[model samples]
Target chain A: MDTLNAGSVSAMLPSAFPIVDKDWELADTYTLHFATDGAFDFDPGQMVMISQPGVGEVPISISSNPDVHDRMSLTIRGSGSVTRALGRLDYGDVVGIRGPYGTPWPLDTAIDQDLMIIAGGIGLAPLRSLIYRALARRSDFRNLTLLYGSRDPQSLLFERELHEWRGRFDMEVEITVDRSSPEWMGEVGLVTSLVDRARFSEADAVAMVCGPEIMMHFVGIALTDKGMHPDNIFFSMERNMKCGIGLCGHCQLGAEFLCKDGPVFSLSRIEPLMKVEEL
Target chain B: MAHIIDIDGLDGLIASLKAEFDVIGPIVRDGLIRYGPIGSVADLPRGWTDVQEGGSYRLEPGNTEALFGFVLGPDSGKTNLFPPRAPMWTYREGSFSATPDSTRPMAIIGLRACDLAAIAIQDEVLLNGPYVDSHYAARRSQLFIVAVNCTTFATNCFCTSMNTGPRLESGFDLGLTEVLDDHHFVVHVGSEAGASFLAGLDQRQATSDELAEADQLIDITANSITKRLDTTDIAQFLADNLESPRWSAIAERCLACTNCTAACPTCFCTSPVDTTDFDGSAARERVWDSCFSLDYSYMGGDPVRSSGSSRYRQWMTHKLGTWIEQFGTSGCVGCGRCITWCPVGIDITEEMAAMRAEVLAKEAR
Candidate 1:
């Protein structure tokens, strides 16, 4: 038996810091940008565990570009107790953070190939980092396309970024709303409807999707129908993750530990499990 | 020459062990044998054998005067290694601090061969995994194990088929084979610590005949195990049969009371719980969690495993199938704790046999 070095064992700890930048606020949702404290480093599509001292920790996607090493951003919706407490934070309020855990989107697979990004509601938060990463190396990829949908115009996140992305000649940006008011002038219906309007070679495109479970399921089907291989399509999955590492049993989907194995997994790998009812 | 000790020398050995470590051994608790701190050598469950079958366990006085007659109980080394509840961290002002309670060095006595295998399985899951469980690591590193070779078999025992038991091969500080008829114990030193511990005790070199007799007793116990699990490619077989109706069939009888997972020697799943005090302080704790629990797979609102069939399927498949992929070994040690402790008499070996038979039947057609 190997003797264990007691000094090596350490528990999960989070530090306190204030939100440096509060970018945008949508219905029950907001984006908080903070300094990385030089310790926090992450790739695009990875998430961090954030918490308020008395409150609990919740896994939130890193919405900022990876190139910006000094700071990171998290887009959150006040759904549960922890998120509700986070929503009440001001620009200088303190919060705790741990990790930049989980596997990132397979960007290398999309290199030199056309990329189609699909997101629904706040699901766009994680993909926002991927978009920035791709744009930073715009000449490396063939084309960039984004199809984003929200509950309505009021629920749309990163409005400025969407407008700027639409104006970019190197990218195709399409927006849709599930329901529209008189002032709303955009496509209306499920996000899957916009998949037909996007132009990309089915054989050469690498699709990345993030959304509600039902939305991702249908979008996956639509992508498959477009002649894209299941292996080429990737989606982010969400579960009640306690520890960002694999020790906690909360984020298990079949044999896979979603926290470490992936929050992002290929459709081919997870399709069978996805079909299983309630799993 | 094999080192052997007379049955009467157990008191001196326990006294020597108690001088440096907290000696823990089997004791009758609530009519069931369990490992607890021993104040003296008398704490050992002498002449007591537990009758174990599917969904049942009963303590009965044995015919022999053997000290280590009991095969196992509901508790294994896992209770002390990976405790049921451990504090991960505590938060007071605005920061979190690790509160890993320093554990006293312990000498766990009367560990069976199957329980030793279970400890190794836990070592892989808790210490060798991508993220090490600090509490388990701290407690496990300080353990001095005294393994007992099995001389008796329960009806639910299948360690012989699992290739984990009836005799201690390795993974112990010291291994002992109790020869009730001969009134002696054949002691095998596995670690230097065990060798040093033996140096302080009254021991004698055993004759070849005495050593051979101890070996034969272990062989008899191994052969006596009527329950068996055919583990030939069993992991892949279970994985392939994820959608098999056998799971639902077993689920009908499985109460999903989580007794199997709780009693399982190698089930290392845990769930984190956060509790807040009235003083505005909070602590995060990781408690022993079972996959059978409805909230085990909770994703905010509803649980992923909504049906008992799915929960049971997850538990069995993870234990017998995916655990091989994750840990390079089967999670089960064939101790039969799950079978004996289960309220509904759901036997894992029986389930596996049914699945295997179904596969063979399908191939025949």
Candidate 2:
């Protein structure tokens, strides 16, 4: 507490600049690709707080694989003041970055076991990192299946990667839309329905899900119905996070600070709280 | 080392401390005893004590003419350390700079044992946690604490059950116990600075009998506390009974006014707000927040805790239950300010006892 020594004082400051190298517009959301300064080190499910200074800061998940350390990407929709400001930035613009905070997905638990990933809408952003990490270490994992659903075909993220992943012999990718137009040829239903068609050994497969809270809850029920253990299912939660280091109480859920203890938690741990209304 | 000083010597002690520090002590303000800067011994709440109960607090004349006769007020040491609102940093254009207020060393006098315990809880949450809040750290490191051993207990007080109050054992630079019968004060030096401060005062080594008298007085105050809460595994019990119907029953009368959390010395929840000036310069400010507030759990539109029931549950569970899990200690110091300040007379000890009773009855059935 001795004047918070210079090093610890600067911990909250987002001094690192990650310049946008390329930007892609997918429907209402934009994905910014940045070449890291080699100073940013993170895990697949870790996230960084990005700020535009005069505007504000928001926690965005690292949407790219951690193995690709030289580059990073964050897919953000224009939801709030900070995101709207982020959406306005052009290529070569600099955004302040701090932290790769929160517990990463339990990828180690899925090693040498069949893995299933379910994503809804833009919830696919954080899961994209896990998917890429699993793909990069494909030999270490058994059968891999990704069940993704969007509001419609246009809302799907990583469209190009989804196509390439479907062609890969080692990965099974299923694409679905809530409502599809005539041009769409894939399944049209909720993402939970894709879990029914997904073929995996319930006893050995680990499921990782990320989406709206309502969707994740239903998907959790579907996974449980398939004879999946509650401990084997992980879900990433979203809350108002001010300080990613857990000092701010904005992300508190029960005894846990989602920013520190988890953004990703096992169903067995959070199921009871999640079942309680307005908790 | 322990020292004894005549009751009149308090003026000289205050004068000595005022030379180098902002001496803050209990003073009568608007018919209430509150901690504020005291310019002289005249500002102290002399010959006054407080009558505190659920939904009421009033200042009353003390039977003995002692300066530190009052038990405690709504505010504690945390009001200065954490503060209601503080600027974390200022931002303009694309750069940000943190300006932590490190000036003005503070000498807080008349802190009760329970308040000291509450400050320790804040230290664990704000200073020793995974992240250090720079604002809290800068202010806390400069504090000079002078704790007062309680000689009186209000009806709402339950510090005996919490094992944190009515006597000063640790977490203070200097400790004082009033011996009104002898018209003197027994002082214990807790640190090097405290020893030096006592050395400068016109004081003498305390007699063993005088020290024993002070211990007896504190023991009397501790035993006089009638209010109590059974804390044996209470945290785990509350955690297990999250869905209990007692919460709804309490919610029927509980008002989410947030007064309890505001007066709570250890409730360290805060919200960061970003404000921009006309010149396009913006600064992020950290303000005290309570879980009882609907917006404390707001993500965007509807808050997670929308009902009075959920908000009340969140506050009690976090304070008496989950706080131990998160910070390795119970958040409640049993100071009883929450009970006195609550608008609807929702006593936390009563609720806890009721919950335990319901659990026990269910088990029996």
Candidate 3:
């Protein structure tokens, strides 16, 4: 029952411990929660390992903002054992947490440049931090746009936050779902469609992207076609991470260890690894 | 310096080695000779051997009572040096920690010449590469190799084509050549540790005639192997035929089950997984994984090599083509382990020959 605080030494942490916290389902796909002492500092777009006692470990994105507090929050889908166990945890209970691993959004580099954030499905979790960061210092950048898409309306995450964001800044936000209900009145289709529709200066523009792999591929192609430099296009790679550290080669793509080298990488750096099969 | 041990002194030498380090060599396991930790000299597989040819392997009941019986095993000394699973670091509750669990000094008895060549290739990748693997360096530093001259080749073995085995030349602390009537073992000390090791054994110096006998034995062994694959043009052949229809044909047979990688002596690519206890207060663990798995390339939500064809192509290309570009040598030692243990018996040599033939056909047209 020893609670590790900020000053606690690393070697003191137990080998196999869990802090099962309460779970909150965001939309139909996104499930959310914090670790027991989930307040670990993490960069935006970086992930954490979630595991049950006997089952296994799975990589999950920290959906919450690092600037806000010390406690980390994760938005996950109940797809596998760790996620399912994570979904079942009640408030103050415990599960495993082992990261804040991978590179986050380059906030310092985004200064004075146009920012374009593209996200799909749960991919929004990583971009939400960038959105919040940009908006907090909105005057630093010119022309901010956030394009979001998901499978359906029920799958859209952070809807309330997006609504709040729209009201607060002089920014453009577009939300699209693959299929909508009778009340639907917005752009619909794949998220890549928005790439062609949106107008932005490719030069000096830093575009951050996340989402399903297929959608990212198309979006990358579309952005390149639109005169965006591959170097300027940053992507948060999503992979199943077992060790948050670079030692575990699970999240490896070619020479780069995604857990260490990046959760975020420039398109120019990751192009070959992305194209190579089985990485 | 090279010193030869008489047949009678081989047991005493082995006995001394057994007392010092955990002696490991080829032993009978699951109908095959696999390398395992051995406590006694008797644990070595007796009267068992394998013949290796291009994409073919067969167990041979050797009439000679040779303790180190068998061709190159399914695994290599790499398993002992760089294990399938290793924990590099552990993290818990926002704290990071690292612990190194490397191997101590141990003797690997009865190592084949091809596997030794494979280890040399591995050294280039792990030690002499752009980034030195500290774990591999630690384990390799403590290794004591006993290279065994191949009396017979495995069915799928083409080490002669690879210029490795059937006759072992160097890179062993001690070398053995088993002959009928009197089991003669030639000892060559490669390092100071080896010199100190041999000095402890009561073996007399080898005369020039005994050395000639060892060479004759090796020459005979080299000539007995029937299969041969020309590796001179293999790298060029593979590079030229990247998009050839042979890839698809081979892919059709390749199960993508990753048996070849698992059996390969020098295939060191691995992925790690992190796990913690249910309480989240504990640490993280890294486990071993293979490149052939579906999730190896899982970026975002989709895999780049979604099809079996691309996966197979990637595996072979990396082994035969890109490995040279990266490590300055072909990744395969032509030990033929991949062909033998493949559940489908998908012979790499056959695959290469098929591809080469296609290339030839295209050139003719």
Top-DockQ structure, candidate number = 1
**Residue-level lDDT tens digits of model 2 in B186-262:** 99988888888888888999888888989999999998999998999978898788888988898898878889999
Query: Which digits, one per residue and each the tens of the lDDT, describe model 1 over residues B131-193?
Result: 777888777878899898998889999998888988899999889989877688899999999
Give me the displacement of residue A227 in model 2, in angstroms.
3.0
**TM of each candidate vs. truth:** 0.95, 0.94, 0.78
Ranking by DockQ: 1, 2, 3
Looking only at chain A, give the TM-score of model 3 against the true structure: 0.87
DockQ of each: 0.45, 0.44, 0.11
Give the poorly placed runs of model 1, Cα more than 4 Å off: A1-6, A9-11, A21-24, A91-93, B362-365
RMSD of each: 2.4, 2.4, 6.1
The numbered model that scores best in TM-score is: 1
Candidate 3's docking class is: incorrect
What tens-digit string does per-residue lDDT give for candidate 1 at A122-213? 89999999999999988878989999989988899899899999999999999999999899978999899999767899999999999998
Per-residue alpha-carbon lDDT of candidate 2 for residues A1-279, written as tens digits (9 for 90 to 100): 233332346456776365665556575688888777576788877888887766778889989878877788888888777888888888767677778888899998998889999999888999999998898888888999999989987788888889899999999999899999989988999998999778899999899999999999999999999999999999998887878888767787789899999999999998887887767
DockQ of 1: 0.45
Give the TM-score ranking, best first. Answer: 1, 2, 3
